[model samples]
Target: MATSTAAARREEARLAYDAFLEECPTGQLLARISDKWVGLIVSALGQAEDRSLRYSDLGRKIPGVSQKMLTQTLRSLERDGLVTRTVTPTVPVRVDYRLTDLGSSLGGLLSSVKLWAESHFDEVSAHRDTFDRATATS
Candidate 1:
């Protein structure tokens, strides 16, 4: 009886996990886009006249991003079909980043978030300062 109960519990857990994955097939995709650098990169691409940028240009445009993180984020975005990477056959190997239709669809949502953050940043900062001071006093 004890063994059977344990097996049932394990099966239940497995089903739950599988269901979660099914519902959130792009959970990791969302996570990648939520990253600071990823958001910056996506926003930059969205704003670009051509809607694309060279890898080196992206690295320079986005402040405080390391080469490794940018590379990883770009690869993940490409794999998730949100971003497309194009390579030009050249001596130094030129590469560019562009958004897919899916990524473009996210542009308005991200822009709204950006607008909210910018508009309320001062208020949020003040609240944080007050909270910090109160916590320190307590």
Candidate 2:
């Protein structure tokens, strides 16, 4: 009886965090996960040789990301239970990152989005150019 009540309560709490509501916790999560850096870093880690890469390797793989920004995004992903950070004691101390199971699930979705953007950029750009020209004259 007590176990059943606990399970019911857990399910209720889970149902409360709706992403559709502006003030919901899931909405906050959407904002975090939707960051450009988050998507890129996740995709990079997911596509690595063994789904892991050293910190420096990640920075190199991701162009236009400053060291500080890379560090910050990795920290954020770590905090959110998406990526795992491992430290190895070496001459220079190596740090490696990999996506967790939860992150791997998200990785597939983000990678698809990245690929779609790559696939459709020319068409999207043409639409954007038309919009800009039309809006400029009106």
* Candidate 2 lDDT, 77-118, residue by residue in tens: 999999999999998998999999999999999999999999
lDDT (CA) for every model shown? 0.83, 0.95
Q: What is the C-alpha RMSD of each candidate to the true structure, in Å?
A: 6.0, 3.5
lDDT of 2: 0.95
Q: How many residue pairs in model 2 have overlapping backbones?
A: 0
Q: Model 1, range 7-122, lDDT digits (tens) per residue?
A: 89898667755624756535556666688877887787888899999999999988899999999988987887879999999999999999999888876677667779999999
